[model samples]
Target: MSLRLAPSSKPSTAGSASVFDTSNSYGLHDTMRFGMRQIASEVTAKHPLENRLAEWENTQDELKMNLARNMYGMHAPIKMAMERSLVIKARGPSMLPRSSNLGLDILVGKDETIDFEDFLNVPELSTDMVDVHTVMEHQLGIRV
Candidate 1:
């Protein structure tokens, strides 16, 4: 049988308190925060190792390329091409004859500097040029 108690008629003077005490909840929150921070630190610790490895690999590759370039002279094809393009070609002998008399040239209004454009249009060999084989056979008496 359940026991039943009668209600008290006297008024109580004590202040009412909550069934669940939330006054000390801040300590639990702090503990949880600290645990999460520790986990986060541990998780991120491995990233630096991977990042460092990648950086080291890049540095090594760069060093190897530089070493190869130093050991072998002009090994790069593009560099060679650039150097070749930058080189100034030596000019060939002038086809036109020069006069010994400076006074005659000055009177004729002929400038000392030859115009390269004038000879550019001219053919290297004359129109009446003979074949090499014919000249060799006729002059040297050599049989083909």
Candidate 2:
């Protein structure tokens, strides 16, 4: 979206100038138009934190799956031990804050343990986050 402001003595046949001041009447059409465009631009510019957050989430999922497979003895003992150590270190006391969910206190212990089954069982949790339709629209830039 683009906003342009041009002074004119009278409205053009093509389209009306966004803002105009005639006599004592002060128009703010251009200001509002530009403001909306600026807002959209700001929203679309993803923050550094968002990129980092997506990376961290991907890493966490990979680690969780590796740990789960190791715990079930699907992997070799040496590999299982390494995965267990990594899981323990990742869940250490100092890492508790990093595991916490903003506006949602779901962790249960100093170990930062959270039962995935129990968490998924919560009706509120299932409905609270962004829905698939909302995510699709946001990704596709389709505004209703």
Question: Which residue pairs collide, candidate 2?
Answer: none
Clash pairs of candidate 1? none
Residue-level lDDT tens digits of model 2 in 50-118 = 545545544554555555565675565446456556654554322223443422322212245556734
Give the poorly placed runs of model 1, Cα more than 4 Å off.
Answer: 1-48, 76-144
User: In terms of TM-score, which candidate is strongest?
Assistant: 2
lDDT of 1: 0.40
